[model samples]
Target chain A: MVDKKQALLLEDFDIEIVSRDLNFYYGDNQALFGISVGMPAKQVTALIGPSGCGKSTFLRTLNRMNDIIPGARVEGQVLISGKDIYQHGTDVVKLRRKVGMVFQKSNPFPKSIFENVAYGPRIHGTRDRQQLAAIVEKSLVRAGLWEEVKDRLNDNALGLSGGQQQRLCIARALAVDPQILLMDEPASALDPKSTARVEDLIGELRELYTIVIVTHNMQQAARVSDFTAFFYEGALVEFNATKLIFTNPKEKQTEDYITGRFG
Target chain B: MSGSFSENLIYGLLRAITYAIVLLVGYILFDIVIKGLPVLNWEFVSGYPHQSGASGGILPAIAGTFYLVLGTISVALPLGVGSAIYLSEYAFQGKFTTIIRMAIITLAGVPSIVYGLFGLGLFVLFFRFGASILSGSLTLACMVLPTIIVASEEALRAVPKGYREASLALGATKWETIRTNVLPYSLSGMITGSILGVGRAAGETAPILLTVAAFFLPKLPNSIFDQVMALPYHLYILATQHPDAEKVRPMQYGTALVLLLLVLGLSLGAIFIRAHYRKKYKW
Candidate 1:
C-alpha cells in the first residue's frame, strides 16, 4: 500500500522488486485492484489474505507468470531491479530468469532429479556438463535437499516423497540463480514437518534474495516474513512490519484475521 | 435369481452367445495360423511373385504396400498432428472447431468403399492424377486421416493442464512449449494413431482399387503415376481372377500371412513405444 518514492537503498532495506498500481483481471472479473508494494532485497515479504483475495494473482505478477492464463491480464508496472518488466521489448524469458517462482503444490517436472535441476540452466544455454553438475549440487545444498537426494539424482523426481519433492522444486527454482523468488503458498500443500522445513529454508534465503510469498496462514507470515501485507476481497487491507501487522494492526480486518475472528 | 425357468434359460442363452462369438473369432485365428504356418518360408516371404503355377514370392506387392504406406505417412503425419495441435491447444472452443471435429469423426466411421469412391472422384477425376500409387496413397491417407487426427487430438487433450502452464510460466513461447514438451510427451499416443492408420492403409483393398485402379503391370513403380502392385490387390487377383491357379495360391497365402504379420508388428511397435515412455516419464 505504501507508494512513497524513496531511495532504493533506504535504512530499512534496499528494494529489489517493486510493483506500482498493479491490477489484474480475468475477463470482466477484476481480481486485484491497485496493488502497489515495494519488496525489500534479501528479505521475505509475505502476502497474507483470505481465500479469493487475489494474493496469488499478485504474486504471479512478479514474474509475469500470469501471462500463461488464457483470460488473465495484468495492468501496470512490475519493476525488478528498477527495470519495468511489462514494458514492450522487455524479454519475458530474461525477466523470468531473474525472477523465479514456486507453486503451492510441488511440481517437479516428470524428469530425473538431475534433469529437473539442470533444466533452467540448459534453457539459458549452459551445456558444459561439469558446470551443470556443480550448479545442481550447489542449488540442492542451498535448498536443503542435497544430502538426502545426492545418491538418487538420476531417479525420477516424482519418485521422491511429497516433502522431498517440494524441496526439489525449490532447488529447481533456485537453480536459475534469480535475484527474486515468488512462492505462492509453497508450504500450504505440505505436512507440518515439511512446512517447518520450508519455513526454515525461507529464513536462510532472506540473507541472499528477495522473496514474495502468498500464504493463508497468518502465523506463518508472522513467523517467517519481515514485512506482511494483508489482503481481503482483492483489496490491500494493510501493509506494515510483520510484528506490527500481527500484534497491533491498523485495520480492524487485519486484527480480526490475525485473531481468527473472520478469516 | 431368475423368476422363471424360461427367463433363466434366456439369460444363460444370451451369455452363451457372447462366449460363442468370442470362440468363433478365436477359431478363425487358429484356423488361419494353422493353415498358413506350413506354407511360410524365407523364399515365400522375400522371393519375387512367380513359380510353376503356384510357387512364387510376393516381393513386389510387399514393396508396393510399404512404399504406399510410407508415402501416405509422409503426407498425412504433419497435417494430422498439426490439425490436432490446432484443435486441442490453439483453437478456441467454438462451433467451427466443434463442427470440424465432428466431421472428422464421421469420416472415420464411413465405410472404406465410400472413401474409395470419394477418393476416386477427388484423386482420379477431379485432380486427374490418374490411377497411380500417389493417388492410391492419397485415397488411403484421406481414409485414415480422421483416425490419426482424432486419436492425436485426444492424446493432446489428455496432457494435464499443469504441463502447459509450467512451460508457459517458464517463459517458453507457446509453440516452443508445445514443440519441446507437449509433443514429445504425447508422441507415444500419436504413434498409436499412426500405426493404426498404417494398418488400415496396408490392408484395405477397395479404396486402392478405386483410386489407383491396379493394372497387371509386372514391373516396379518408380513414381506415384506408375501403377504399383500392392499385396491387397495381388490377393484380390489371386483369389478372384485366378482361383484355381495353384502357383498364385501359395503366393496369396504367403501374402495373407505377411499382411497379418505387418498389422501385428505395427501394434507391437506402438505398444513398445507407449511402454518405453511410461517407464521413462513417471513425473
Candidate 2:
C-alpha cells in the first residue's frame, strides 16, 4: 500500500471525486471503514476486491445509490467536482445525473433500442423529436453501439445479444450526459469476447468521463484502469497506479490477492 | 431402476389426478350446454321477460348484469390499483403496512352473504342510494377490491428491481421511474387481476340480491338509481321462487349458461391482453 503521504499527493492531479473519512453502514452492520481516496479527472479508477468486501458499497455511496435501501446510512463527505454531495439539501437526482451508473446486469427497459437510449434525455426534459433522436444517436455512437443497432432502432432492447445489451445499457447511461460514470461489474455477466468489447468501450470512455468501476477480475482492472484501489474487509488496503498495484504492490495483502493467493 | 420406477409411478398418479379434474369440469359444462342450448334463442336473449319469467326472454336481466359489471369496474379498478401502487411502491414497509396487508387478506376471505349484509347496511340503507344499480355496483366493488389489490400488488412486485435502479440512476424521480419503467411492464398483470375481480363481481348474486336485484321487472334501468334484474338472482328465482318452478327450469339453465359465457368472455379478454403485452415485453 502507498503510505498516507503518497496517497495524499494524488490530490495534486485534477481530481474529479474524493471521499474523506467515509464510513457506511447497513443498519447496525458497518460495511466500510474510514476510506479516503482521490480519483483523478478523466481517468479510470478500478475498485478490485473479492465478493462482500464493500467495494460495491463504496462505489454506491459516491452517487447515493445506497440511500434506497432501508436503514442504509453514510457518514463523512463525498465531494464531486469540489462540492460535498452528501451535504443536506443536496439534489440527489441532480447528483445522480452528473454521476451515472451501469449495473452488473444489463437492465434495459422493456422499450425499443431507440427508447432505451432516449429515456434519460426524455426524463430530463429533452422534448422535440429531432433533438431526442440526435442525442440517442450520439450516445449510442459513443457507447460503440450505433453501428450495430442503428437500423433496428425500434426493435425491443431485450432481443439483443448479451454483449449488445450491456453496450445498450452503457448507451442508456451516457444519454444523460453525465461527467462521471460508475460501473458495477459491467462485464462480469458477458462472455470473453463481449468482455473485451466492453473493456475497449471503457478505455474510450475514460478520455471524456471520470470512471470508477468495481470488479472481481484483477486482469480486468490492470487492463482497463489507470489507477486501482484494492479493498479488503471493508477497508482500503491499497490505492496506487494500476501498473504498481499489479506488478509491484506495496502492501502484502494486495500482492497476495493479485498473485492468485487467498482473496 | 428403483428410482426410475418410483418417478414413473408418481408421474402417473399426478397425470391421473389432472385428467380427473378436467373430466369433472367437462361434464358440468356439457350438462349446462345440452340443457340450455334449446332455450337460448335470439328472442330469449334479446326480448324482455313476460308472464312472470315463464314465457318471454330475459333481456332486462342481461342488460342489468352488464351495467353492474361496468359500474363495478369503474369503481374498483382505480381504487384497487391505486391502493396497490401505494402499498408496493410508496408506503414504508413496517408494522403498519403488515397490519394493512393482513386486513386485506382477511377481507378477501369474508363470505359473499356477509358482504351482502354489509352492503345492505352501508350502501343501500345508510348511504340512501336505495336498492338500485348504484348500491349493487358499489357493494360488488367492495367485495372484489381485496382481490384486485392483492393481484395488482403481486404484479407490481413481479417487475424486476433492476429496472427501478437503472431508471433512478439515470436521474429519474421515483414516480417517474414507476410511471415509465414499472407501470408499463406490470400493466398487463394488473389488468389480468382486475378482470378476474370484475368477472367475480359480474357473477355474484348474494351482494346484489339485497342491494339491487329486482324480482320480475321487465323494463331496463333508466339510471344507476333504478333497480335492475340481474342474471344470477333471476336464475335463483326461476329455479326456486316462482310458482311454476318446474316450468321455468329451462329459463334457469339458459340464464346460468349466459352468465357462464359472460364470465368466460371476460377471462378470455384478460388472457388476450396478457398475451399481447407478454409479446411486446418478454422480460
Candidate 3:
C-alpha cells in the first residue's frame, strides 16, 4: 500500500464512516493491501478503478458481504458510528441492516413489486399491512420508481424492465432505512437513458443517505459524486473533491486515468 | 457443397435413430394395449382373484401397490429431501462431501435382488417386522432413497445463488433465507423427484417379494403388519406359478397393463409438476 499522511486530516469533515488500515485476502491471495479512507456523511463518494482493482471488494467490506465467501479473510478495522464492525461479537445482521447494498446486476426477488420493497421491513418484523404499504411507497418514491409502478404493485418484479428492476433493487435497499447505501456499479448494465435516470436518482439520494458507489465510467463519477477516490492495484491512489480530481488531479496516475491515457 | 452434404447425411441418420426409438416404444405400447384391453373392464379391476388368480380381477393387488407406494414415499421423501438440502446448502465441498456422493452413487447401482436379500435379513428376520407391508415399504424406501437423493440434489442446485445472496445481504439468517427463499422455490423440484422415485418403488418386485408380497391373497391388507398382494407378484404367479398358467393369460396381461399404467402415470405427474414450476419461476 502507498503511504499517505493525509489520513490525519480525515477528521476535518463530518465523517460518516472510516476504514483504518484495512487488508483483505481470498484464501491466502491478498486482494487488498492496507487501505484507509473516510467518507463524509450524506454525500456521494465514487470509487473509480479498472476491473478487479479492489474497488468492488472495498465496497463489499462495508456491509461484511465478504463473510459469505468461503476461505475469505479480513484484517484491520471498519468503523461506523465509532464502532469497529469487525470487533468480536458484532451483530452482522444488524450491521447489514444499517449498511444496505445494491449489486452490479439487478437482483429483485421472485416476488411481487410490493413484496420486493417490503421484504426488508417484513424480515425485520414489520407485520401490519398499512405500515408495509407505506414503507414500500416511500422507498419507491425515493428511488424515483413509484409513479411508473404504483398501478401494478402486485405484479411480479421480474416483469419490470431492466432499469426498473435496478431501481426496484435500490428501493428494496432503501426500505430498510439504512443510513449508508453502497452501490456497486448500479448503472453499469443499463442503457444510456436508464443510466442517466439512475445517476440522477443517486444525486437525489445523496441528500438523505451517505452513498458510496463504484463506477467504471469516469464521467459518472464526476457527474454524481461529491468526492472521488481513485484506486489502482488494490491501493487508493488519490481522493479529493470531484471537481479538483477532474480538473487538477494531484497525482500523475490520476491525471492519466482521467485523460484515458491508461487504466 | 460436400460439407453441407455430410451435414445432411448426419442429420438424416440422427432422425432415423430417433424414429427407430419412437417406433420401438410405440410397438410395445400398442401390443400391451391390445392384449390387455379385453380384460380391462371395471369388474376385472375391482373383483378379487379366483381359482388361484386364473379366473378373477386383481383389486387386492391394486390396493396393495397403492399402499406400498404411499408408504415408500412417506418414508423416503423426508430423508431424501433433507439429505439433499444438507449436501447442497450446508456441507463443505471437500473429501467428506465427495465420500458421501460416492456412497450414494454406489447405492444407486446395487442390484434390486441384493436389496431384497438385505431387507429380508434386516427388516424381516432381525427386526422381526415379519413379511408385512411395513417391512416391504421400508425395503422399497431404501431401494429408492438413492434415486430421490440424486434428483433432489439436482433440483436444489438448479436454484440460483443470487436469491441466497440477496436474502442474506438483507440481514436474514441462513436458515431464514433457506426456509423462505430457497425451500419455496425448490419445493416443486423436490416433490417431482419424490414422485419419480415413487414410480420406481411402485414397480419394484424383488424387495416386496421377499419382504411382503403374498402368493394369492384375495383381500386388502387390514394393517401395516399384514401380508399384501402386489400387482407384479400377482402377475408373476399368474404367468408362471398357477396350476394352469395358460388358462389365466388374460389376467396376466391385465395385471401387466395396470402396473405399466400406474408407473407411467406417476412419471407423467412428475413431468407436469416440473414444467409448471419452471414456468412459475423462470430464474
Number of the top candidate by lDDT?
2
Q: How big is the positional error of residue A175 in model 3, measured in Å on the Cα after superposition?
A: 1.4
Could you tell me the interface RMSD of model 2? Answer: 0.7
Instruction: Give, for candidate 2 chain B, the lowest lDDT window spanning 10 residues.
Output: B196-205
In the range A1-263, model 2's lDDT, one tens digit per residue, is 45664566565569889999999999999999999988999989999988899999999998999999988999999999999999999999999999999999999988899999999999999999999999999999999999999999999998999999999999999999999999999999999999999999999999899999999998899999989999999999999888778887898999899998987
For candidate 1, give the lDDT of residue B5: 85
**lDDT, residue A250, candidate 2:** 91
Candidate 2, which segments miss by more than 4 Å at Cα? A1-12, B1-18
Flag the better candidate by DockQ, 1 or 2: 2
Q: Model 2: per-residue lDDT, tens digit, B1-283?
A: 9999999999999999999999999999999999999999999999999998998899999999999999999999999999999999999899999999999999999999899999999999999999999999999999999999999999999999999999999999999999999988899999999999899888888999999999999999999999999999999899989999998899889999999999999999999999999998879
The DockQ figures for the candidates are: 0.39, 0.81, 0.62
Candidate 3 backbone collisions, by pair: none
Q: Between prediction 2 and prediction 3, which has the larger TM-score? A: 2
lDDT (Cα, 0-100) at B132 in candidate 1: 79
- Please, what is the TM-score per model? 0.90, 0.95, 0.94
What does the lDDT come to for candidate 3?
A: 0.90
**What does the interface RMSD come to for each candidate?**
2.0, 0.7, 1.1
> Each candidate's chain B TM-score?
0.88, 0.95, 0.94
Q: How does each model score on lDDT?
A: 0.82, 0.94, 0.90
